[model samples]
Target: MALTTKVAAGFGGMALVLMAGSGIASAAPDDSVIVNSTCTYPQVIAALNAEDPVAANALESSPMANGFIQDLVNTPPSGRQAKIDKVRAYPAAAQFSGLIAQVANTCNNY
Candidate 1:
């Protein structure tokens, strides 16, 4: 009876752990949802509008005025806005500002 109880408890714990892991996996964002720039600026606009309202407003307010977005558009590698993704992923404000400066300099001619 004691051995059976212990086995049942162990199985219960394992079930809980598996449930938690599956929940975490489901909660993770899907990378495929991210729209690539080559899809068209309107698609980028729609994706941004759906995913980030504040950033989308900033873009809509002055799409070209945003140095980072403008830079990515003007000198896009592979004609895509991958640079914006790099800038958006910056964890710190200082790093983002630095990227903005770099973009400005790189796109100055445009």
Candidate 2:
């Protein structure tokens, strides 16, 4: 009986560990882009739009792809207009339409 109890306890402990691990995994966001933030770009965009539609529109309309903006972070743009125009062209590029816009935008800032 004592041996059976020990075995049952071991199984329960293992089950607890597994459950805890699953919980931790589930807590992670599937689409988070910020290094430590839970917010995805879509979520951040939504928040920005909510806070200021005009600013959000400007950001969306800006030619810089999201990715390019991120990419140019350290260097920024000496010629801002030119940079925007170039990045905006990415969406028109065949490989960068619709959902690709997100990646392009993300890379813009990379």
Candidate 3:
């Protein structure tokens, strides 16, 4: 579930971090040089909970992704129809529910 993403500029455009929970990082390929990193749903919640700097850097790098996450948190979908409606309203909402579920579950210690 790793996704190569864009990082905040200060980390250097060429730098791609990791969230495998191993703390190891590597350089992004030339074709995907803009990618900063990717992680499973749980890894992100864990990293944020632990106050890990890597997660902080990644979010800072991508304002779009960060904003998307913030919007989901502020207004959650009701159900399948709600999710479908979200997609109809904004395409990115499709990813929102799963992320919110994972985060909410983790927060509830599920």
Best by lDDT: 3
Quote each prediction's TM-score. 0.32, 0.30, 0.32
lDDT of 2 by residue, 2-109 (tens): 322322232111112111122232222321222223334565456545544554454455444344433333232242323223332222232212222243234323
TM-score of 1: 0.32
Q: Mind giving the per-residue lDDT tens digits that candidate 1 earns over 21-54?
A: 2223221122112222233334434544554455
- Per-residue lDDT tens digits of candidate 3, residues 18-50? 211112233213212122223333454464445
Candidate 1 local lDDT, residue 108: 23
Give stretches of model 3 more than 4 Å off: 1-52, 79-104, 108-110
Model 1, residue pairs in steric clash:
none
After TM-score superposition, the amount by which residue 59's alpha carbon in candidate 3 deviates from its true location, in angstroms, is 1.4
User: Between prediction 1 and prediction 3, which has the larger lDDT?
Assistant: 3
Which 10-residue window of candidate 1 scores lowest in summed lDDT? 11-20
If both were scored by lDDT, which would come out higher, candidate 2 or candidate 3?
3
